[model samples]
Every structure is written in structure tokens, then in C-alpha cells.
Target: MAERKPIESWLTDMDGVLIHEGTPIPGADAFIKRLRESGKPFLVLTNNSIYTPRDLQARLSRMGLDVPVDNIWTSALATAKFLDDQRPGGTAYVIGEAGLTTALHDIGYVLTDHEPDYVVLGETRTYSFEAMTKAVRLINGGARFICTNPDETGPSTEGPLPATGAVAALITKATGKKPYFAGKPNPLMMRTGLNAIGAHSETSAMIGDRMDTDVLAGLEAGMQTFLVLTGLTTVEDTEQFPYRPTRTVDSIADLVDLV
Candidate 1:
């Protein structure tokens, strides 16, 4: 093993690392404050593409967590970036909310159902049978498939709800085409976030709760990865994975001093 570069920039998951169940986790405020005071570029990342960054910023503000809109990144943004790079000003038949649609429109993508260049799938509370049928038909008609993230389920007050991955699976069964996932565990999301902040992966760090997505993405992207126990993965749970994060802390509070 070699000596790693100092962590100069940070990327962290939003739900698990910063907050839980719509509430701000303890020490989350202090962590954000320190990052801002240090003048280091940082981004709060999330796979949820239901709400735009502005909506998320306002929600976080209510929780007393000061996160700027620009400092937040979402799977929606990543998917849009990927599409723009692949086919600039292209047309798509989208099945998602404002977060995903706004991103595509911002990149000059036209949303249509008639022989689009791609059938873009994303996170949405309501999955309409009609819309999905249209997407399947478009994909069958030769449109390339793209998805924001591969998360099979999303958290909710009641329980886990079927997310983009699950819905994408349904569409795949119907169309016989696998959509390209643009978010975490793919490393493209990490790279896009790093590029947005003008940060180098070698000198950056990623803080996330899940070993499957967060830690895996960071490790593959050549950044130091920290697993916080405040969310999904546990100490015992870490042992089950074939790979491990660079370090594991009790919570976000433990990372404040490093910032």
C-alpha cells in the first residue's frame, strides 16, 4: 500500500450521512459549517431524483442544515449530464418528476413520445402504467435506454418503495433492453460530481452510509471512502462485503474535525 493524498474536497450522501427520516442527524450542522468555513469544495449527493436541488435546499434549511443549491447534486443531474455528453440537444421520452425533467430541459433536450433518441427513466412517486407502456414501446422502437440510478428500493415512512431500479427492471422485462445507470456504483456519478466541483479524485474523499453504492463508487473512482454507521451499514454488516471502506466512523460527528 502507498501513502494516500490528503483529502482536499468532500462528497457525501444526503439521506444517510447528513439526515435521516427527514430530520437532521446530530453533528450534521457542525459538519456542514466546518466544510463551508474551510472553503473546500463539497457536494451533498442523493440518488433520489424526485425533487430539484432548489427544493432540496429549502427542505434542508427547514431542518436547520445550511446547504446551498449549488452544493447539492442529484442522480437527475448526473443522468442529464450523461445524456448531454452522449447526444447533445437530443430528444427523450421521460418518465419522472421535476428534478429529472428540469435537468433534461436545462440541457436543451426535447421531451416527446414519438420516436425519441432515448427513453430516460428516473425516480417518481407515481409510476403510471400508461407512461411506462409508452417508454417500453419507445425502447422497442429502437430508442436507447438510460436510468438515473440502479437503487431497487427507496426508503419511506411506511416501508421501502420500488425505486428507479425496480421500475427499470420492469421496463427491461418488457423491452428486453437494460438501461444504462448513470448514478453511484457506476463511478460515473462520482466523476461527474468531482468534475462539477473542479476536484481531483486522488485528493478527494467520499462519506456514505452504504457499502454497496457509496463506498464502492468512491473506491472505484480513486478516492478515500468513509462509511458512517449512522445510516444503513453496521459494523457486523461491513464484514459481509468482499471490500471495505478506508475507515468507518460512528457518525457524521466524528468527521467534523477532519473538515
Candidate 2:
């Protein structure tokens, strides 16, 4: 009935949409390549806060995708930005690996467990009960609570493992303070990604695999959303959600021609 708006830029979820279990999905690399060649601004959005952009780039390079480090946006980075904007040069008691720590450090945040301004939770391979206990006490003692993502579990070679959200829940139960999540499903993360790429929401498309995180975040950010049935979601799964994606495809392969 009307002319379709051209997508001038894009934001894509990394784990499910582009790769799965440490492997690139078929046609994902080509899709990224096409975006690169076309000079369209795009960003790879990830909720995984375990790795830095350089580490992610190396991993993607091994999978034959040549995404530059700057093209990758992570929840850790968004969390750091949020902290910096809220409290410049603030102190934090962080529970994560190099990715989260590095981002905070880059923004001039001091990491401390001694009466810190915030208790920032992030994804990690090892979830120590001792550290979690410390976090609970700190929040009880009046530190603000923040989290990188709300994913209750993360996929691994073995199986799904408890993630930041699960741990945050434990802390919340102990202290009765819910964390402010900084990852997908939060429109702030999507807006931060768009700001990083200098892209407009109206002409941008967000490609994701999950209806809850990717689609919701994209829609909240005022961008068109596309769901790819490559990982967690299926055609039937969409019905479970109250909202629907602007488009759905079997895989990224099906959308290559549109590039």
C-alpha cells in the first residue's frame, strides 16, 4: 500500500543470530560482509559480558567473520556508560571478568569492595558463592545494585549454566533490592548501540533470535525488528509473546538478498 522504508543501518544480536555455541551460523558471515561492503552502519550487540571487543573480534575472525572491534557493542560497555553517566568516576564492587572490569576501568571507575557506590553484577564462567555472599551483604549495607544482563542461564558446551540474572535473584532475595539490568530487553542498551553507530531508529533494523530480548529491545528503541529462527526462537514461539517482530525469516540466509 505504501513505499517501504529502506533500512540504512542495523543492530544484530551476536550469540543466537550470528553464531551458535561458538560457531558462526550459515550465511551470517556473508550477511556481515554485505553490510560492511555496503558501508551501512551496523553494530553487533551482545549480552555476554565475559569477553572484550578484541576477544570477540578474534573469536569471530576464527569463524570467518571480519567484524572490527569497534563494530561490536556489549552489555558491559553499556553498563559502564550508564555508570559513568550516572556517577562520573564512581567506585564499584564488580563481580565479573576482564570484560566488565576493563569497561569500568576505561571510564575511570575504581573497583573496590569497600563501601562502593554500586554492586555491579556481570556474567562469568565461575560464580563463587563467597563473592555472591559479599555482594548480598554490600547491598544490605546500602550499595546500589546493577547487572549486566538478566539472562538466567547461559548456553555452554555442556549445557545451560546459571547466569547473572540467577545470581542477581539470589542477592535480591537476601537484600530485597532488584538490580537495574543493563542489557537487552532494556531499551537503554538498544539506544546506546544506536548512539554508538550514529544511526537513526526509523531507518535501522534490529536482527535477533529471541522475542523477549532482541525484539522487545528493538521495538522499545523504535527500530524495526527481525527475528531469525536460528537459535532460541521458532515460528511458533513468536505466538507466546504479546508483541510480534516486524519480520521473521528462517535464517539470516533468507535475508541476504535484501542486503
Candidate 3:
């Protein structure tokens, strides 16, 4: 086997690795501080498309994680980038919040419901049947379909909430069309993120909490993967997956030295 290159840059999931349920994880602040002090390129990644980078930065700041706006990346941004690359300045019928809409708008995509070029779906706290019905109808009218991520559920104080992927499934069942997912588990998300930071996969490492999305995406993108147990995945759960992360640690604190 070929030897691996030293990790120079970093990519990490936001929710599980840094903050959980609106609280900062122990050692997370120090980890971010170390990364900043090192001057190594790093990005905070999230599949949640409900908030823009600015909004997220504020939220994280409240939790004591001082991540800069430019260091954040989201599924909404990735989806927008994909659309911009495929069809510049295209029209779309969007079903999402400011994060998704703002991203598309920033890329010169007009949001409309009449004969749009694509039906874009993204995460939102309030998933209205009316908006979903419009999406299904527009897709039936020959509009292409695009989704930010494929996460079926999202975390909440009460419990799991239906997210973009669940709504996307409903629209797919109605129109018999599968929207292209542009988030983690699709190497596009990881590759685009790496490119955004001017980091190469060969010298970068990804820190995540889920084996399904984060680890898989990092591995596919040719980066070393670290599975932190501070979120969804348990140590026992790691055994169930066919592929393994490059390393597994207890939490973000464990990786502070690596930065």
C-alpha cells in the first residue's frame, strides 16, 4: 500500500463535531482556535440548508465557537454552485428558506413557479404541503429536479423533524423523478468544499460524526476521515458500516492537537 501524505488542511462537520443541540461541545472552541492559529485552510461543513453562512456564524458565536463567515460551507451553497455550473443564470421554482433562496439568487437564478427550468428543494423548518404540491406539479411540467441534501430527518430539542430529503421523497413519488442530491455522501460536496478553501484532498482531513454521510464523502473525495463520537454515530455503530473512517476519536477535543 502507498503511504499517505501529511494532513495540511481540515474539513469538519458543524453540528456534531462542534456544537450539538445549540451548545458548544467540550474542547470544540480550542480546536477551532488551534486551527486558526495554525493558519491552515479549514472549512466548517453542514448539510442544513435553513440558514445562510452569516446566520450560522452568529448562531455559532452565541455558542462560543468563533468560526468566520468565509470558513463555512453548506448544502445550499453546493446546490447553488451545481446549478450555476450546469446552467448559468437559470430560472427555478424554489421550496426553501433564505439559505437556499439567497444562494440561488446570488448566482443569478430567478425564483419562479411558471415553467421554471428546475424545481429546487432544500431544508426548511416549516415544510408546507402547498409548496411541495407546487414543486411536484412543476416537475410534472418538465422542470428538472434538484435537492440540497438527502438527509431524511433533522435534529431538534423535541425530536427528529422531517427535513428536505423526506419532502423530496414525497415530490419524487408524485412526479416519478428523483432530484439530484448535492450534499455529503456525494463527493461533489466535499470536492467543491475542498476547492473553495484552495485545499487538495491529498493533504486534507475530514472530521465528521456520521459514517454514512461524512466519512463516506471524505473517503470518496480522497481525504483522510475522522469519526468523532460527539454526535449521532456510536463506537458500536461504526462496526456496522462496510467501510471505516481513517480514525475514530471520542470528540472534537481529541483532534485539537492535530490542527
Tens-digit lDDT string for candidate 2 (34-97):
9899999999999999999999999999999899999999999999999999999999999999
Decide which is better by TM-score, 1 or 2.
1
Window of ten residues with lowest summed lDDT in model 3:
125-134
Clashes of each: 0, 0, 0
Q: Which stretches of candidate 1 lie over 4 Å from their true place?
A: none
TM-score of each: 0.98, 0.98, 0.99
lDDT tens digits, residue span 118-237, model 3 = 999999988888998889889999999999999999999999998888998999999999999999989999999999999999999999999999999999999999999999999999
Residue 50: error of model 3 in Å?
0.6
Residue 215: error of model 2 in Å? 0.5
Report, for every candidate in turn, its global Cα lDDT versus the true structure: 0.95, 0.93, 0.94
Better of 2 and 3 by lDDT: 3
Clash number for model 1? Answer: 0
